[model samples]
Target: MALALPRFAVFQSTVRQKNYLRYIHEDGEQHGFPQFSGEEIVSPYSKFEIERAKSTTAEGNDNGFVHIRCCYNNKYWVANSISSDSFIIAGADEPNEDQSQWSCTLFEPIPVDGEVGSSTTTTTKTTVHVRFRHVKLGHYLRSLVTRDNYHACVSTSYDRRYSR
Candidate 1:
């Protein structure tokens, strides 16, 4: 089942080196692809707004598929093509269900030893980890290590590295 996602959210990488998804303006103007930001704190550049798709596919209707729009630029996320290893970028001025819609799912976050609270013996989880599955490409959204940074892309396999 799909988890109830917030209208606006900050997608963070689930890898060991955790970071939030952000877009850096190219040429200090327009057009920028999604990348993982090194900052640990949430910022306007990292926050995105979720918009419901106008129509749903038979396979994604029950999965709560939706379009992810960047709050910084007001552009929607678009899968490059109907193929594997395509880059997901925030460039679409409008939402197209076939190219912009993504099937979202929730995953249980891996717990780290030092991450647990010490004040209380027991603690309750409040946040939900999410992953975006490309409708046309049939791959999960993942980040690729580019030089010293990571860029957003799609992969065929299921892995925690794809969780945001």
Candidate 2:
């Protein structure tokens, strides 16, 4: 016999706009806009965090550098760089049981093309394909909000290091 699960009611809140400038610009240095004062506005929900990472080959080496961005409440942390033969899978696919539903999967590292750089200033580019499967409803919802937060942090960190 299979056990039955209870259904929980879902509640929706009114959407409001709040000052996220502080989270966006946690660092003291300002670039695009002036510092924002703590202000509150009506919002349905708070924003979620998300992060992105990249890998590249070093000059004269067959292997490349793999970077995994760290998560932060505020967008201002450096991505921890690592040399590995790994990659992350990202995407969505239809669920097995429900055609109307979708799933997402995080996979292990896959092989990628890498090239060596000649000088320190040199850079190489490569394309990566990611796929998702077996995504859960709860995980998906959480990911939806978290992804944005992660992205903001990664963007800020990348800008600080690469941008002139």
Candidate 3:
């Protein structure tokens, strides 16, 4: 049996109630995830189109939603409308060491009377209510199944599992 991964919760209060984009850095800098300043250069193969498509699909909804674009090795991992506060990774890439980049965008909640017309207008109060959760189940797997020091051997696992 596989071990269960740990869960992380991102609350609206923790992230601040603001509708703005930012990044989380290794040095505990919430606004420094990319380790860069100014406009970011994205790859042509990046899932910019896919991200826009997904965002379009989430057009009007009352629930809070957030989209996060994670870039690494010229690859883009787009997570849309992550309503949950926690994330469980059976096995995932590392944080800072992997040279991965992440950008978070908060979307305003759609109004209750919003319509789906050409000029539909929704009174969605712009606020930051997206959260992130990083849980690693690899540790339990290593201790229970492989019986090897997976945490110490795999750099990615080590960073994701140990780093805060």
Candidate 4:
């Protein structure tokens, strides 16, 4: 279902709010998605197109994330380059790494407009962002849009980056 979709989307963590999965756009150069926080907004590279694992890793044992390639760099995969911080989402001649895979799961669908909350107040849900997890890393994807690093990036798992 996810592989069939194509858009510039980010995965909001099911466990944490205001977190997303993203990569660095260092002046159009390849970079890694290692350290991220709530300092970013959104970038044109944030959007991506998802597809199957694009490999023959076995049939039923394939309980993992899909392959997400940046729409900007159709040749690059959301994987690490040579350096963990410099080259994150780079072009892969043959992609077969764990960092290149992402499992997107929509854990929650926002409530309807007429829905009432625990406080008895009407709720209005607008957007519907998906939840994507890094298969091997076990960290959720997030958009860490920031100004300090023009090549901003997304954190690994939770806001407390080093923690799990």
Best by TM-score: 1
Residue-wise C-alpha lDDT for candidate 2, range 131-161, written one tens digit per residue: 1111112111101113332422211111222
Please give, for residues 51-99, the per-residue lDDT of candidate 4 as tens digits.
Answer: 5554343233233345656555554444342222222343553435443
Q: Residue 54 CA error for candidate 4 (Å)?
A: 5.6
Q: Model 2 segments beyond 4 Å from truth? A: 1-27, 30-56, 73-164
lDDT of 3 at 142: 13
- lDDT values, one for every candidate: 0.57, 0.21, 0.23, 0.41
Comparing 2 and 3 by lDDT, which wins?
A: 3
**Candidate 1: segments with Cα more than 4 A from true spot:** 26-31, 57-61, 99-126, 148-164
- Summed backbone clashes in each candidate are 0, 21, 3, 14
All candidates: CA RMSD in angstroms?
Answer: 7.0, 19.6, 15.4, 9.2
User: Against the true structure, candidate 1 has what lDDT?
Assistant: 0.57
TM-score of candidate 1 relative to the true fold: 0.67
Off by over 4 Å in 4: 1-47, 54-64, 79-88, 97-128, 145-147, 150-152, 157-164
- RMSD in Å for candidate 2, one decimal? 19.6
lDDT of 1 by residue, 28-111 (tens): 422466776637546777877876555543352344567788888988777554456656777778766544434222112222
